[model samples]
Target: MPTLTKPKEHNRERPVVFMENVSKIYPNGKTAVQNVSLEIEEGEFISFVGPSGCGKSTIFNMISGIIEHSVGKLEILGTTPTLARQQSTDVSFVFQEPTLLPWRSVLDNVMLPLEFRNVTKQEKLEKAHHVLKMVGLSEYTKALPRELSGGMKMRVSIARALVSKPKLLLMDEPFGALDEITRQNLQSELLRIWETEKMTVLFITHNVFEAVYLSTKIAVMTPSPGKVESVVEVPLPFPRNEDFRTSHQFSDIAAKVSQDLKF
Candidate 1:
């Protein structure tokens, strides 16, 4: 996509997600990612912003160990997707869609992931209530998915992701499908959760404003056959509110991100 740089030498402590000179070429010889390197530390919110087909999802998959890299090193939990999953409950992904089962109640849907772990049913129930409350859905615990709005359903999805108390949370455009009002509302809600949970987050978004509002750092990628173009820092203080979004500083940082998305 653009002239790529050499991968950086990383510290041995191994930041939560570490990639060095990584590339992924499919069987048909199509290269989706090229020489990408990044380091994410604990308790940081990192967002990936890029245009369509620019390998944002590819880099995301590599971090989650969903797919392997053809070259260079990726140090997550393990090499294989299955191993990556089996090795940890410390990581969780919240996809764009809520993906709730129709029959389950809101509380039940949130509790489902915990069922797979070694905890007792009582513990699972407790965790479900805790996260549902965290997402401001405590009163809707008994409501069915059909009874909820798009925003509420997504809140359940987020609560489900947090039920495991993960150390790293990877969110893939989790608010992209919502209306403007709902999207902004959820953005505020997410920041609150991040403040309380204090976990590392890796988010993928096409919206520069969203990236600037939620992230500590934004990793901008180039066009197809993606490479890290730049990592823009958001020096804004956290616990941000509506006023922060409307402030000139937020507008300035958002402009920088928009510029990075350019060819």
Candidate 2:
């Protein structure tokens, strides 16, 4: 049996993401999220899971400054979300689809972000190549998106996200589109990247098992008019493998997260 490790206490000096009584109401008078609050510390991997229409993606967009919250306070790295986005390379987002440009090579795709910056062409090339290597896609730098498999394309997406060296990475069901085998493989790969990069990750997914497998904490949300019902801790040690996934502790935590989603 794999030993279950207890989660260590975090020093709550300044959270990477802080939300209090945050709510999002669209112009049509529909409430997407209601009074959702969460505090995520540095280097923690947090996953949000809930039923469909639970406002999981809504919360993500709000945090990323794609949209504004209708009420309450929201801050990223002690600054307003908009300011955090404009003044610093503190955040990045990965969506459900890989969203790669079919015409562009892997290297060019990853270099897109840096091209908009003040860096020289050589500097952009170096940064893009570095991140491609980090994501294990260095050898595929010249391949177009159509030439890669689903998993490989997602790797390119991840590399693009990391090219900016952001402090926070937000993913919206990034692996939901892959097959089981590929999904499991990428889940492990993502963990490896997270550990190596040491960035705060906020991942939204519908898979309770994936959430338990990858996250330090799982935030379960209620149905439409989404509110965080509970945040369950996964007190498992790092470098978790297939053995840990099949362990009793893994099943217990997954079941608990499922129960929370049901309520």
Candidate 3:
């Protein structure tokens, strides 16, 4: 493991992810993101929330190196996302939909990441099985996507993201399509995984309660030419269970984030 370097006294903990005055503009002169800057502490689960066409997805794409920012710096684990990609740095992404292949079994879908960097078939299967166990889906390894329920399929997606043992996981509304009960269940599952694995997360969501319930801090983004309006820290203790949802502290933080979103 590489020796971790601390930042300054006030910002001493080196950020796992950093965005410095980043901006994105399309050829048609539409500015998607505007001068956004934020630092995400290592192992922190930070969420981005905003309305549609507010550049939330664009910001995610920039962080994932799916597209380059028009200006400023963006870093993941001290390296640009593009550089990290080149080095095969540990980072995984889960999209809104499960997006699993219908023909492939759950184990095969989870093992797909290994195929990208030349991992052997045997090694891929072993790693896939390990992560499947982590997500409580070991029993369904041979099941196809069509065979799983919505929540179960999302669990498979989560397992797939973990198969690579990434240090950072980027999720763009991974549970948006699920029913409320399932979304809440997956939210708790995600927190449990993060607590155990200590992976840094940059999640994008429209749901305020989900943002507060799952994040260490919520980054509120404004609509159009989207930029972070506030970073509200959720002081609630970790290993948070369903009981935390009914707590005053969680409600207060969630309310604050909700207000910020409407601004």
Could you say which candidate leads in TM-score? 2
As for lDDT, the candidate ahead, 1 or 3, is 1
Write candidate 1's Cα lDDT for 1-263 as tens digits.
22112245775454677678999999999999999877677788989999889998888787777888899877764344446667778788899899999999999999998787789988998999999999999999999999999999999999999999998898999999999999999999999899988998989999999999999989999998999998889888888988988999999999988887888
lDDT of each: 0.86, 0.90, 0.86
Per-residue accuracy of model 2 over 28-50 as CA lDDT, tens digit each: 99999999877788899999999
> Candidate 3 on 178-237: residue-level lDDT in tens?
999988988888888899898999899988989888988888888899988878887777
Instruction: After the best TM-score superposition of candidate 3, give how far the Cα of residue 160 lies from its true spot, in angstroms.
Output: 0.8
* Local error of candidate 1 at residue 137 (angstroms): 1.1
User: Once model 2 is optimally superposed onto the true structure by TM-score, how far is the C-alpha of residue 251 displaced, in angstroms?
Assistant: 0.7
lDDT of 1: 0.86
Colliding residue pairs in candidate 3: 7-12
Candidate that scores best on lDDT: 2
